[model samples]
Target: MAFENPSRERIGDILASAGNIAIVGLSDKSDRTSYMVAYAMQNKGYRIIPVNPMVDGEILGEKCYHSLAEIPEPVDIVNVFRRSEFCAELAREAAAIGAKVLWLQQGVVSQEAAEIAAEAGMTAIMDRCIKVEEAITMQGRTRKTQ
Candidate 1:
């Protein structure tokens, strides 16, 4: 069967409720999309946990973990920046750590990985930008108050 992303409202709810976001394959470089997105999310009050095996130190002022399992605290969302081929393993790790959501970044879609997350009772979102969704969601909320 084909994979489908959650509804925009659902995505908004996920982002609104999410506190700790573990970014896999996050880069230390500021020019990277992962870094930019994570930085934005951090500024928006979400705790960004950098999970990059390559980075020795912090990426966005938070301690960089080697993997999701290495993170000491609970994770609300496992945002992946890796390629499609690497998502299944990351999904498994995210599930093992009891993450509430498995979010695959834009251009990174995997039916197998989505299925893995679904089977584990995790909300799996594929081929979307978390930062973009958050921006849209936040805008909607702001307009609703106006």
Candidate 2:
């Protein structure tokens, strides 16, 4: 069967409606793409929850969790920054945690991960940047400050 690609309208809806995003693999390093993207999204008013096992403290002032399941509240979206090969595991974890969306950033794609999220009835976005999506979605609107 051919996989479903979310329509532009739906993608825009997901980008704008998701309230909280769990940014997996976000590190303290400012130069990391994960950090840069998270910063952009946060500046757009999306609450960012950092998930990195190696991170001892918080990133972007939000407490970092070792895993998505450890997060205290519902995750509107699980934005993965890990390697493509590892997304399946993250997808399973996101499913287990009951996330509403599974987002694999640019250069990251996994059929297994996509299947896992789709099977669990979660919205899945692959090979896309949440920040870019948000920026485009916010065009002509008043941008919010982080």
Highest lDDT: which candidate?
1
Q: Which stretches of candidate 2 lie over 4 Å from their true place?
A: 141-146
Candidate 1 per-residue lDDT over residues 1-146, each given as its tens digit: 88889899888888877888999999999999999999998888888999999888888889999999899999999999999999999999999999999999999999989999999999999999999999987765532110
Per-residue C-alpha lDDT of model 2 across residues 51-118, encoded as one tens digit per residue:
99999889989999999889989888999999999999999999998998999998898889999999
What ranges in model 1 sit over 4 Å off? 140-146
RMSD of each: 3.2, 2.4
Cα shift from native, residue 109, model 2 (Å)? 0.5
Worst 10 residues of 2 by lDDT: 137-146
Worst 10 residues of 1 by lDDT: 137-146
Residue 91 of candidate 2: its Cα lDDT? 95
**What TM-score does structure 2 among the candidates reach?**
0.92
